[model samples]
Target: MNKTIVLACFLAVTMIYSCKKKGKESHPEVKVVFKKKQVVYQVFTRLFGNTNNNNKPWGTIEENGVGKFNDFTNTALKEIKDLGVTHIWYTGVPHHDVITDYTEYGISNDDPDVVKGRAGSPYAVKDYYNVNPDLAENPANRLEEFKALIERSHKAGLKVIIDIVPNHVARNYQGLTNPDGVNDFGANDDKSVAYRVDNNFYYNPAESFKVPVFERDYKPLGGDNHPLSDRQFDENPAKWTGNGSRLSQPNFHDWYETVKVNYGISPDGKKDFDELPEGYENEGFRKHFEFWQDKTVPNSWDKFKDIALYWLDMGVDGFRFDMAEMVPVEFWSYMNSSIKTKNSDAFLLAEVYNPSLYRDYIKKGKMDYLYDKVELYDTIKHVMQGHGKTDNIPPIQEGLKDIEHHMLHFLENHDEQRIASPEFAGSPDKGKPAMVVSATISTSPTMIYFAQEVGEDGSENAGFGKPSRTSIFDYIGVPTLQKWVNDKQFDGGKSTEEEKALRDFYKRLLNFTINSSALASNYEDIHLYNRNNTEGYNDKVLSFVRWSTDEKLIIISNFDDTNTYNFNLEIPENVIKKWQMEDGNFNTNDELYNQYSSSLNIEDSKGIINMEIKPLESFILKIK
Candidate 1:
């Protein structure tokens, strides 16, 4: 070969290598750095209350008038922002069915307190584009209020995420229902009426009909069912007959009660009926059905794209999808694709309760946030509540890895029980410490549920057709059980020194969790360092770690019942640096301690490192 040609080839090779090296230098390791932002605060439709001793089913942001939101905006949100929260999720904004007949769900309309305030669970939406009247500034100026709220949130530097329920429509929503039995737009209410074969309703294999098996007991303490205290729900549903009784349904299903959507096709190459005849053949019905077949409802795909774009245009940051499993993967694909077309920063967090189903969406990049139920339940709730042992740590660490790659982490959400409830019932002395610790120290995107700030120990499962006073707050807005939350010292309330210390610990923990560098970057490499505990106090200590090529954070949560702990841990030989203490102390070791001790000492019985977590608390020792 000629020297000239060889020299030219060498130059080309050198340029390619240089570009590759530059790329590696700019972006080293697959680390997803979490921006130093506050854990997202999620507000539910059913939880908001007023000073006038009213806990109506639903109300508008504007109607609650400045007073209600003032607490949320000025106090709650301010605290959240101060603690470094990055986003907020406001669920149930759309219109829902106002069920006048409470007997349908075992609720009695008799209680004068059962005021159906203009709106219901926003999930039962009559219109997606319009905000519920109760949440509006005035009936006519609702959208403006939403815009203003978004503006306020943005000003506070919080990304706002609205909930989108696509799986089903409200059972009794107006405009969609044709009173004359003939659907004006061919949108039927029949369960079997499906537009496509894939849209068929889920049927239990054991049962002959298309229904799910639900437990009768609403609250069972230990099992899947929660006990039902409501008197109206005593009758068995299996014994009851429907309009056209083909057979008695022994098992429970997500039927019209929680209407299941038709994704278009069935196993038998048929469409599940909404309310009309299966495969209805009519020019009007076919045309309307075709329109409904498209994912963007109330309008065409182009229009739906515009709706999503409109929110983005308003500086809205993100969205949290409800029952995302029911939505066609194509809809999410289109949403993610279309969203990227406009802005890259827009985040999408889907509420897919099942992890396996969630992964499908995550792989498609359909969402950036998801409910980390596995870790939240297994590690935080179970461990801190004295329900889990040290053995549970390994699974939790593994679960965190799966969740970290594709989710914004959160603790209890609207669908589940409240964190402060007896289920996670740590004593005001014990639980609060663990609660604050777990909320802050995790690597995935963290979230705070409504009423969590004030430490409201409400039930996680409220809407199980029960009339119980165990909600986030009582009817008369005295903030029943408010002591569980109020950071007494900060709020100028009279709390003991220990209580005050616990409250301050939470603030500090929040600061450290969000600002940590190692946690922000390669969290997967972080392993569960030490989950060892007192032999008899296996139920107490919940310890773990998050480390990468550069740093490590050891999290220890003790949920013991006044049991002092003294344990040993095996640390990685390379891990030497330690910084910050939960008790307002910071530590540094310029001279590295080059040793791999099989057992590290654990003197403090309960307290999160860096945040000074107290009994029933969690902490992180930042090692970098």
Candidate 2:
């Protein structure tokens, strides 16, 4: 060190201190207080508002009855809002390949060989500019109907989010209502080459597209007679499949109904567009937006950008991207940055399974949140199945502490098996404890599927979608949810006593989560401490503490399905010191439910609480 340099540094520090003190005096340093936690209610839009209870396997729209946009009445939305949800993710709202014929409305009939079921797969989006015709009472007014639903959702104190499958598009993509200057996906594609920088899709010149050979007993439309059900599709130059299969005839397991989008990355794995600049990973979304404003990109990138902006302009609050890892991170950077520029509060979430890419997706790609599937969800699932221990959870929380707030937690969504399904926990009651830990363990956003609260089993074998997972590909009614719908009255009149009880539990838990500032603030895992020190605290029990400057919470859950736990659960001396707790009996009340009587005793700098937890029960004790 140089003497002059040291002196200059000291002066700089002194000046900064002086300025900070003056700024504080004028600005009046307010107490730091976080907003309420976010709870997202994800609904399969087609199945949510449907009142018809008749669910037949492989049934037509007339046989099973499809839900319409008009079905989401104001009363229904108000009921959902009362569940303490801030956002509603409306799944399957876009147009896709469906077996139903709409030629009279100037909509081309989708070939059954190229479609998944009579209803269709939402991932294989057919049009970027319109809503699904099946969801509308009149096919011509589908977009208008969706806009009205958005208005209703907003009026009910809920934000609206929809899916944007940027990785691929329907095999027969169409833009029936493209804006004045917008063009369809492959309108100007040069099919002469297999890979091009500006081409909308990758091509296999001289090879025509072929439908996959079906397995025995599995047939499109159940081998019914239709002009477009011949297992024959017309494509002069076959494009790569959605999952990146280059074969002209993809395997049955591949995403055969969609075509892969091109984002300037060629077959040689060389980038045709400019890679992100140095240190761009640490830049904010606004800077990312500015970086791409003047840079020209591929056609698919431009088209998807237009589509996303289109929806945002129509009052959509945000988007949940499908299979986001399959697409390039650079494209997400451009897309998400552009979205934020339009609406800075847009909730952008993505499905990136690979844990290695989680940080990249959130930080560099400018995504608001990513799925915590591989670590949190999977570990919790194993625990519920009796094969995993509560010990395996805290390590995951510690590992992701740096990005924990950006990880969104959920129990069920469209892709996963329902909690009440035979393949899952075999009963919805087993999920109670897991839901508590998942929602309050960290500051992450909590999401619950539409019928999850009422214990939907997803056991119906509805055509293309099998048991254990609800069908996203066919017309079918969710029996459990229908009982709660009760003929569009939005009341649980037909629901069984057990079903209503489960929903009531969800209501109490979710309401507490959103209104509690501690849930969105500081956290510490006390599971290990209790296991080592507290007697009778087994691996089936999980414990933690969540606190803020204003509130303190001690949460404990029992995962055992048939065991009742009674023990003196210890809250270590160090944790008590953090809470500024004194050595005496503190007034405490269970925030989750008031059924249990809890007493806290602290003596000689040690804190302990006598706790009695029932099977699949959780207690959120608030210290007074």
Query: What TM-score would every model get versus the actual structure?
Result: 0.64, 0.94
Cα deviation at 349, candidate 1, in Å, is: 1.2
Worst 10 residues of 2 by lDDT: 11-20
- Candidate lDDT values, in order: 0.45, 0.88
Model 2: per-residue Cα lDDT over 113-194, one tens digit each: 9899879999999988998898999999899999999999999999999999999999999989999999899889999899
Models, CA RMSD each = 12.2, 5.8
| After superposition, candidate 1 runs with Cα above 4 Å error | 1-34, 45-49, 54-76, 99-119, 174-258, 267-307, 399-403, 426-442, 459-503, 523-539, 547-552, 574-614, 622-624
Error of 1 at 175 (Å): 7.0
Tens-place lDDT per residue, model 1, 279-314, is 221111112233334343222223334556766786
The TM-score of predicted model 2 comes to 0.94
